[model samples]
Target: MPIAALSDLAGKAECPLLVIKVGSALLVGKEGVRREWLTGLVAEIAEARARGQQVIVVSSGAIALGAATLGLDKGGRGSLADAQACAAVGQIALSGLWAELLGSHGFTAAQMLLTLEDLEDRRRYLNVTATLTRLLDAGAVPVINENDSVATQEIRFGDNDRLAARVAQAAQASAVLLLSDIDGLYDRHPKEPGARMIPVVEGVTAEVKAMASADSNSGMGSGGMISKLQAAEIAELAGICLVIGNGQHDRPVARVTGEGIGTLFLPCRKASARKAWLGGRLRLKGSLVVDAGAAAALERGSSLLAKGITEVEGVFERGDPVAIVDGAGQVLAHGLSEYDAAECAAITGMHSSEQAAVLGYAPRSAVVHRDQMVLK
Candidate 1:
């Protein structure tokens, strides 16, 4: 069957790494864990593995499982302590189920619990990325989740939708599947009389974002359409494709990929080696704002010169990832800064020939060399 959306990228060779996000409501309910659904999902994952596809799962439902098992009263808004307790208790059961299901298919399931801070901190981010890379290399499925048990508002993502996007970026996944309750994004609420599902989104525009609803049908899941769109934007920025589809169908994973029964958010474009490296950076040290002329030059694939820089924000060492914004505050690109922040400050607006007189050094003509930059 022809892919429903993103037909250009339907082939197996196009997607080497696939990250799938499973919503909580589909996995847990008042009746408890959904065994039949889990079984089908695991079979789909196994089939992908047999085809040499690398898969990672970012799953939800720990709190719902914990709440049900502990018999917690859920009649009103729950306290942080209650949520934390539920997550702690529920994570065990959730991980166990994944392990058992995958093990039955003769594949190992490794659990990875992470908080927002883990990804924000450069060191911690690299460490986690290394661990995930090792696990995937060993032919193990890394089942990841937000560390909800200890994640407070200060360090919490509030939902796994955005977290899954981050995981996809870190793992360098080509495609991500968001298995939600709904089949795809609609022009209006799906239940409304004249709602229409948008099959393909080449880009996330203001009009497209307006189509999403903030409310979710599942009380067990934290993310709604708004968060999923935010995740899609994130994935798009990182040059990764994302599909949002319903998890209720049989072989949902396979169908979404092969038949395209979902809304596919295409990336801006395929990333070159340098662009991919720059786009995947989780931590950026600073930013350099340039004039419109410089922005235009960069867009035309020209090198950035010191004379083009208008201002610098934040302290950054040489070789750190830095944002390159235009005069209107639009992010034009991201690249490695050739000079330190202090040097950049001293040399801003100076001609290339004048750099030696100002700093007694001119490492290169460009503040951010063309070879190191990725235009957004």
Candidate 2:
């Protein structure tokens, strides 16, 4: 689809719930937070809300804002701690700007900072979801950003693009609008000749993946087209449409919503909220090695059993997350463990009926219940 065609489709989408992810590059220009751009973006969001559309803003610019405020040179970070500190300072200023901007339009904005852990834990994920839903119900636009100041690399989403996708999934939003410096995904680097724009990506095929490059043109942001595609994949799985375009475009959201410009990636399938959270949110803690027959059954969407368990690695206690590994040691999926490390080790290769006899007490009916499992 061409940009014009996508814009037409976007306009025709019914009661679309929008998730707008504003990149740091557009938020902070060479000087600092471009007040004109920020004001314009907020006005667009306010307008969308007035039209009876629910809008969730996933914004990035904390570190950049902090750097500007602290007079630190861009890209002069000496350590992760330094970047974290910058994010801390920047987040405060970022929230203030959003509050003031939205307040001018007689709309209230609530700040939500989340780390990957919040999405990884089932309880925390539900809590965050409930909070956002209530805020939306109350007609307050929620401004979400990663808790970068306190997030470690292991628990970080690495970039806001991915974070936005997860947020879209969590909020069950209809579409995710990735507002960035670039217009859309191109056949090659847009700077290169003959690199045409790809208007609609139906799915992330191998061909589409090949076209992705990790080059970053935005000085204030970490992600590029590659990260955006990854985010799109997550959104697609969650049954959310995604639009990627230049945030610099005037009335960007309205334009994208009303026959503007961008690449639209349609949804492939819709995963239920519980399934989406289980499949895409939680991070695995350990692995459970199963026999070949067990692997085949699991591949066919069957639950894992103790009879199939040949070995268990890592010291995960009951309820801890663990990857279901095949006989060859390839990870097939992830699920919560029903038994502790010692219990699993003792019951390995035992029949289902023998579980209680060997362990003295049965942990659960299955080693990894299908309900808790998610294919990788």
The candidate that achieves the highest TM-score relative to the unseen native structure: 2
Error of 1 at 247 (Å): 1.4
Mark the regions of model 2 whose C-alpha exceeds 4 Å error after superposition.
Answer: 1-5, 8-15, 187-193, 205-207, 258-260, 289-293, 307-313, 325-331, 341-363
Error of 1 at 103 (Å): 2.1
lDDT of 1 by residue, 1-376 (tens): 2223544333557776888999998897668999898899999888878877789999998988898878887711188888899999999999999999999999999999998878765578678889999999999999999999998866788888988988887787878889989999999888999999898898788799889998888766889999998888778877788889889887887677667678998876656534654664445789999998898899999888989999999999998889999877878888999899999999999887888988886557688988888876
lDDT of 2 by residue, 1-376 (tens): 2222455324324535678999988888887788998899888877777667788999999988898887777642546787798899999999999999999998899999999999888899889999999999998889999998988878888789989999988898877889988878888888898998887888776688788878878766888888898888788777777888888876777666566567888876676677677667536667899989999899898989899999878887888888888877776877888888888889899887877888887557888898878765
lDDT of 2: 0.82
TM-score of each: 0.78, 0.86
Q: Show where candidate 1 strays beyond 4 Å.
A: 1-17, 50-53, 67-86, 115-134, 149-158, 169-174, 188-193, 205-215, 233-239, 254-259, 280-285, 315-317, 340-343, 354-364
Clash counts for the predictions, in order: 0, 0
- Ten contiguous residues with the weakest lDDT in model 1: 1-10
